[model samples]
Target: MIEHIIEIAFYLSTALTLFILMLPSQYGPTPRGSSDSAAEPKTTVQVLVLGDIGRSPRMQYHALSIARGGGQVDIIGYHESDVHPDISSHPRIQVVALPPHPFCLQTSNRVIFLLLGPVKVLFQVFSLWWILAYRTKPVKWLLVQNPPSIPTLAIASLVCFFRQTKLVIDWHNFGYTILALKLGDNHPLVKISRWYEKAFCKSATAHLCVTNVMASVLKKDFKLESPILPLHDRPANHFQPIQDDQERKEFLLSLSETAPVRGLLKEGKAEVIVSSTSWSPDEDFSLLIDALCRYSEISNTSKPRLPHILAIITGKGPQREMYVERISSLQNNGKLRNVTIRTAWLSTVNYARLLASASLGVSLHTSSSGVDLPMKVVDMFGSGLPVVGWSRFKAWPELVTDGVNGRGFGSSGELVEELIDLFGNPAKLEKLRIGARESSSYRWDDEWTPVAGKLLGLV
Candidate 1:
């Protein structure tokens, strides 16, 4: 047994040596003020923001908040098609794009990901280490987004330790839960990932959660003692509703010719319902689809005076084609006449424009993390578009108050009834819209600036 233990230790030491050799050489001694002792007051705080998922807006928001708070931020993230302009154009912000991963990995193929995921992750970690440790200026803090479903915190923690920077993980969703959704909860990899997640989260210097419920979960489930700030998404300054009717008309006409809005356009007046979905199974968009279909049936058969419906569904995902086909089938069968459904994968500007012009918004997201609030709902409220959201999430009450700013529903039947009642009464719809606008008076900058300042010790 002694000989076996020695052999194992020898192999582990060898692997450690090989890993050290593989890392890029550090450039000279650490600069002054780069050490932990250098946490003194500085004119400009430098922050390194890392995000594995490129499409996430939370990272962008955080970066903007940091920049607006007088920090120079360097964002290292995966390449994405629709990068937000505010992040790209900020004077103090630098955006670094990672080389695209292989198509197989991008598609989330379980077999190929299992085969090549480790190698790919190692490459990414090395690239990040080289950037954070050697390439960029000394950073005071490293803010990372979780739920790339990988153990990124482990890598960030090591980087922070060596660079003498604080590591702040903005927990969006737990990787283990996402893994369990993709694989089974009993899978060996899932179990291993859960262990790693707990370990790394416990090691972080600070945590920022999307909702208060998530912070509670971190404390109870992971036993994480790190100071956690619940920084929910808020509307940017640009998300105001379009008060001009001509601008709304022009915006409606700028939509794709294939969009379902043409029916509404011809009617001179229309009821525009907007909903955003990630197209994942967790969202249960079928509920909204069923509600829309039922609303159409009721409008045509029961109430003839209801305005024509133009339902705009925004976002693209793996399940997009399936849902698109489902909606198309309903339209072809003439079951959806009073309502025309359109699926649009829009840029940030166009999406905001669509939201600003919308009469009502629907959010089907059921929060795969159960604790994190649906950001789509936040964006809807930001646009002053009243929302009909799922009632199940722990954070629902904090964002949506039934019969107030927005309403929540537990079932498709309830949602359909609510939709019918709201659309049938213009006074109620207008009241909800006013409530949405009033509720969204709080700004992202207002909520995040102080929290970010506190996290960075800038306040």
Candidate 2:
């Protein structure tokens, strides 16, 4: 019944929008068919990211690419964090914050979650419609992020239908699979979520999936008529490897002054390992902690002493403080040694530098859909840093070439073995680093411009 009501609203919003467009120039905003003579020469493309704009790096990259191709873009999303200046400051790109989702979204209690879900969906529908109908100007091409499939996909499809716009969906993962994580896979909600994803996905004029595996599933199963482009995340120009040893030296000296990692720095003596996390449910930080504990044992009580490790975990999420407490307990109890674990929330500039300067990288992502690749690993590769990634998924092999660019581990014991083997054997570590460095050549524009850029009308 609620889904029916939302479907009705989609049509109603279209009718109301059409009415607004028919009004006189003085009475209402400019119509979809007409354009401002003084505005940007190229048609404005709208990128709708229902999630946090700052955190949605791939969508932001898409907007940036469009801008680079002499296109103006209206990036509509929640400005929850500081955006990279490249997009926010670009003359051709405009970031528009959506009407905020008005509900307690952080509640983990299933009962409270179930109770609040309907009201939240209702609010999202109205808020999204209000923005599309009255706030943003009409666009020719509208690109939206999936896994936020429910309201976003439905609403985007409706707006595009009425406005004569082409809908493009950038698939990161399946919304149904993610919902199944919270509500069991057998749950009715999970089943409905899957149905909704398939139904709305057909409305897309073009699809950009994170992996070829995802594209195959969408075509074979969903039977989408649109052009499916397997668009993997590649690092932007800013994420460059540190070529100058002196620059890395200065970067470490600067990071050592920061409170979180203060007194934790051993400079040249310590091997700096960087890991990024959202601290979300899919990521099991316990695996990382367990591996570190075993690594400490190998370093202290074993032969061929390993260098001290300074582990820097970056990014913010709900589970952050819990892991911080666990890390503190390990350190204070003397159970974790030769390893100093520190967490940070860094700016884009600092993060790129961190990736470039760090000796190695770690990934804890277990894709909810088991096919989506982790973008963090791509960033590490861009900076010529070899990664030790979670290999519990299909797409990891496509991104991390086991023995080439990086190594993948399925268990904590394996991870400990990997850490000890690589860190203890500098020659092996350097070889992997060399292989990862080759990936630095694969820039975003190099791949994007040839396919997605041309598809989006980029010359």
Candidate 3:
């Protein structure tokens, strides 16, 4: 019996060794032409930002940045109706849309995701590998976006290993932390995801994080040694404020089907409060609804009645229908008064236009990972719209000051008070508008050019 146990242990050890050997190692063969190509003409670096292109604005930004810098970029992403025209029309960037992943696997149910996640990832890895290996140019570097980090990094690492290319992981949030939000911290799948995260993060050639806080978390939690660069998202030039009132009026008229907005436009007294959300579980839309309801209740008894409010909530996500039903019920019950809440899935140009025309912006995003800053707030600021945002994470203070470009609130009640005060006082709103405009000079091109150049060895 002892001899049989010893034999079993030996087989297990050997199997583990073989599995380790099969994985893409951190070390690999030297890149092509390292020894003999010193005299060869310089070729433009070919970069592929592989991820969901339809939803990821940062990926679009990265591809555009490289292309604008005279590098060739092939963006392998999934198709969505709202994908920006700028990406498809770019001379130096090529957009390849991958087929949609399985619908059942993308469901919000944590158990379903956990049970079938590996199978889904295996399919993704196979498709991505085929594209990377045979269908594309000899890529010098591949920048992958994380959160769905397991398969993205795992497959990218394998391709990089064989092709002798560098893998740069742009870390937005940890996939495990996001899983923990839905599945709890102690779930077995979450534990396994955490392990995969650490292993894959360590294997990457370099890491680009959205904020300094994210970079710090990676260092402290994962003990990553690869160079980490903080690459925050900045506004594109198209996000600027509308210069012509006529154009703004025309756009407003186009949405006349929404009665409150049309009435406000006719009266010229509409206090448009725009909020862009992913409609995900992380965003507490109830808080925004509660605040609006509270403000309406207070205004009913107060002198100098509030102006008509047209609250525009934008973005598409799985939880959207749930919120829409909730809001519809409230409106039907007359609990929410005097405010017209419109939910829209706007195209890129329309989204920018809406932000540009809005009087104020609100962000209800409480980060699933406490490190990454909200890109929606950045986009709002870009359009010169002052924001009132939730202050739950460390990165909030970096983006907003209480009375500066935006205000940050900790609770629904506090947000209501702030909004009431702002609506009652026009001068304070003007000050915030000025502050937002002043802070809007930080553009994507200026922020990403130097970093992309350095990372790709162009500068």
Candidate 4:
């Protein structure tokens, strides 16, 4: 019995040795951060842009472009369906994949993600801390894209505290108010989240806000001394004009089948394109649709029929089903005379093309909906499309100088009135289009170059 056991053990040991020898030397997940001394010489400016890459393509493009343009820029972003390929290709731009939490979003593949959530969070936290500990001596600046969340901001603050690196908070939305409005103010989760937000904002050395309104709120409420730099997220310049005239004609012809184009060019039928992600109370797209339907009822038919409105409502959320139902009901009842609703995942390039063809763009939300100047607004500028919608938030008024580039409406009644006025007059639309192009030009460059330069003392 002893001799047989000895023989078995010897064979097992020999097999294990063979397996190890045959196995590949390098076998594991992709390496994180810089591995070689080559990335050592240049200034390392690590920028973390977490959550919703698709929502801010133009902003992401500019941020990544600027980072790579100067020195070593390491970018860690959340996993979106379509990722920016440039980041993957760039030598300096490191793309860290962040898996979504199952607890936060619903999915059939729940168990796997639920286990992964805690693991990912721990790994990310550890990786960030490791960067702080090891890379600080060489690192120059640390920029957090929207340092308003606890896990994200905590990492930024902790790194800044010990590493002695300059901390930049990219304030996309009012941390507390956005969560309170999005997930309900009474929510226990939001209450805890706000505490982290306040701490991070206070500790930040500098900030980048979407508009002057956000800066004011941060100054007044947070009592933060950090320079709240006003930067505009420029529109993504991906849309190339249709080279083939025949192809363009066919595409327009297909569109005419659904809704007849009555003198779209001759009489100048102004097309209003509204592409909003959220149909929630914050977005208030329902109000715009309601106001349009109301205006269509009262407006005179003899007058050049108010530019055939074509509003494309995209995205999926809690309010998605209800919004689709509402629009469908309007069409069924013949209440929606000219409005058209198209729902789907819009590629950045395709979305830009749609905006290019559109005569006007609109973004509407309530007063409470602050800090969320939808990235679509930037796309509107990139496409050189004028805007017309409710401008209650502080950013709206500043970004879109009402009556200059876009018309601002306070109430639902005002939104309706403005739409009517713009549709009735074609020349006003032309002037606004010119203004939009001019107004948005500054915003495009502001995203990365000037902001990064300011942070690095290069500006």
lDDT of 1: 0.76
**After TM-score superposition, what is the CA distance of residue 55 in candidate 1 from its true location, in Å?**
2.4
TM-score of 4: 0.75
lDDT of 3: 0.78
- Tens digit of lDDT per residue, candidate 4, span 114-217? 45545655766765555544433335667787733646788777666655567777777756676566557887657777776876678887888766777787
Best by lDDT: 2
> Higher lDDT: candidate 2 or 4?
2
- Superposed Cα RMSD, model 3: 4.1
Put the candidates in TM-score order, highest first: 2, 1, 3, 4
Evaluation by TM-score, superior candidate among 3 and 4: 3
Candidate 1 TM-score versus the reference: 0.89
lDDT for model 2, please: 0.84
What are the per-residue Cα lDDT tens digits for candidate 3 across 178-291? 778788889888898999989977878888888888889889989999898888888888788765767766776676435666766767766788898888778888899998
lDDT of 2 by residue, 296-359 (tens): 8879976767877878899988789899999999999997778888888889999999999888
Task: Tell me how many clashing residue pairs each candidate has.
Answer: 0, 0, 0, 0
**Clash total of candidate 4:** 0
State how far residue 34 of model 3 sits from its true place (Å).
19
TM-score winner between 2 and 4, please give it. Answer: 2
lDDT of 3 at 59: 83
Off by over 4 Å in 4: 1-41, 103-139, 159-165, 182-192, 239-272, 299-302, 367-372, 446-448, 457-459
Find the candidate with the highest TM-score and give its number: 2
What is the lDDT for 356 in model 4? 62
Q: Write the per-residue lDDT of candidate 1 for residues 326-423, one digit (tens) a residue.
A: 99999999989888888878878888888877778988878767887788877877878899888886778878888877888988889988888888
